[model samples]
Target: MQNTDAKVIDVALKYGYQSVDAFSVAFKRMHGIPPAEAKKQGLKLTFYCRLHFALKIEGVDRMDYTIIEREPFTVVGIRRTTPYGGGTWAIVKSNGNNVTAEKFFGRFYDLGLCFGFGQDGSNDYMCAVEYDGETIEGFDSFTYPAAKWMKFEAKGSVTENVLGSVWQRINNEFLPQSKYKKSDLPTIEKYVSWDEAADICNVEIWIPAILK
Candidate 1:
């Protein structure tokens, strides 16, 4: 599903509805806002440069900004096909591989975005701060180091939009908010990617960082 359609669904469910029109009615009643209002809130997805596209920095307002001690771990993952509003493991499975969970021990970042929290209940779980960039066939294996993590959260239907939204937000708002005084580290997103048949994705993003 596209971002627009996903927003419509979220609004409808929030207001309680068995139908789209009924949900729209309830939406306007509760918030005195129309369902279209959600869609009208067009978020910026492009930044100053194409290479640096923009995304909405979510969950930032809720960050604790307090440091927490973390232990390191290893994660075995694969860089499979991830569509904008699709499933990651599902696509890989369709290609005839089972979703294998690895003993991923690494730094965990709290962005409030997990796989099970989204439409696809399977993708949500932990967010990795750092992982070995080694690309292996069928799957990738890597280890993350203990570091300060900046977590960003976002809500969207299509999987791709969620990633893009957070990326844009970081580049436009969060980075500048800190006066570019902080160090930039690995940027990772926990998202779902399904086959062409599936749509809708929820994402959580974690970028390594430290106070300037």
Candidate 2:
């Protein structure tokens, strides 16, 4: 929204957004308001742009992650279908604030695992527990084939910044420079621990990956 000589779409393109809709969504997510509203209210936006978008500089903090291979496994729990990149995953707040989340976590004492499936659109989500050959009457099962994965850490009590940046950092920082490429498998989220009173939880993002 800064260049007077450029169309909105042109500005979006220049900044690397494929389309204005994606740009606006990102803008709204970052600023807590739609770009149109900010523009209408005359809100001047400023950002800290890194040089060449690189951190080749020494002493740059590294993201926390690990590479591991896992055998075939299955998760059993509640499942829901939602549009890809919709409010389901877009939530910047704790899963504690969600009704579905409340039920999913509350009912299961086992370590929580969320499985997300999609390509370009249509997300199938399952909030479940690791299956041990026992059937969960009210729940369903989602099985994952054996694969290697990149595991990312999402720390802190606030889900918005920590969890949200997991995807961004993985895509922009890790994948771009690594010898690993994403594989065709569902993205898995493991809830390591949750402190309801403190609203603190350890979340792990696992993306199926293959080495180049």
Candidate 3:
């Protein structure tokens, strides 16, 4: 926009935007003015330079994970759309319908049927168990194909910080540096053990993946 001679549509395409209108919307968001308004000589503009990456050891803590092939399976249970970090444990504990994890899945599990926001965000979650071939009223189901997944362990009581840290490591540190890309299968969070009386939880996060 600062360059009077530069065509807005041409510049928009160079940066991967599909159209000039889209680019102008993004421009106004960052500069507080549309492209046409940006031509004013005295108007101040916000400019950020390109980012550069460097090699450095990020943390001393280790992120331990294992890769395994899982057989295709189905789940049956209640589904809810929640925020990025919230899980369904509270619902399971309070339900008068006797909708416990043991009732559906034989164990505890959190399966993401689909993500919500764009660019690495939360998804639709199912408080489900292994499907028994019987459809219960008010319950949903999904069948996943066999695929290789990487599993990471998270221990400690259930809290935003404790659980969020595991996701942070995977997104910030592991995925950025690893030789694999996340697969299309729904992400799974399996609760290996839970003690509501003691507020203790042992969990595993499973991310389907393919070698890049």
Candidate 4:
């Protein structure tokens, strides 16, 4: 691990952080220590490296997905401009009273039609469902262009962050080994269930890709 202060600053800037202090706070939350302390201690850190799809059997977990071309569609729902990492869901949770807000978001997840864009952290995170092209109050509408997509599905305990874990595997493990490359488009997250009280549920992550 390169623990140089210069390297720390470089990484902070590369990740869109405004300052070392901001990056250090996020780093400490993730790695349990300040960046300076981490460097001083020379601790080993795991990195989620960029994936390049190739032919090989590596990940033990099975990743099942299918390629499908869909026509343009529009969705309407509440949207929040989050900073693209942790606490992104706080906005959704803060909408209504505790139970009401939970149910409001849960309804969308239960319908298995919720969609998200802006995974790149450069845009707002929109939580919405397919809707007519009509304007709706208190909600924003977005149109998804027609394109090819790879949809991976997983079912497991929500407490385990199943969706997030599988997404990491797909991006870091599967994409790097496959014959396809990601496209410059927003990825989609299709929730099969959003039962906060449930032990398990289903979810899907969709990535826009093209054959390399």
TM-score of each: 0.40, 0.56, 0.59, 0.59
Candidate 3, residues 19-96, lDDT tens digits: the string is 999999998887778887765544545433223455844465656666567788887766666555344444545773
lDDT of 1 by residue, 76-139 (tens): 5434323323355444446543323232323222122222333443343332223445544544
Q: Enumerate clash totals for all models, in the order shown.
A: 23, 0, 1, 8
Candidate 4 residues 59-104, lDDT tens each?
A: 4445555666778887666555555442335555565423442454
lDDT of each: 0.45, 0.62, 0.66, 0.62
Higher-ranked by lDDT: 2 or 3: 3
Which of the numbered candidates is closest to the native, going by highest TM-score?
A: 3
| TM-score-better candidate, 2 vs 4 | 4
Cα error, residue 90 of model 2, in Å, equals 13
Q: Residue 204 CA error for candidate 2 (Å)? A: 1.1
In candidate 3 the C-alpha lDDT for residue 135 amounts to: 72
Question: Clash pairs of candidate 2?
Answer: none
| Collision pairs in model 3 | 105-129
TM-score for candidate 3? 0.59
Better of 1 and 4 by TM-score: 4
lDDT of 2 by residue, 1-212 (tens): 43244566777798999999998899777666666554342243333223353556532445655566689998765556666643343331334324443355454333333345467566666556676576656666778888877777778776456667666767776677676788766677777776757777677888888876
Ranking by lDDT: 3, 4, 2, 1
Error of 2 at 20 (Å): 51
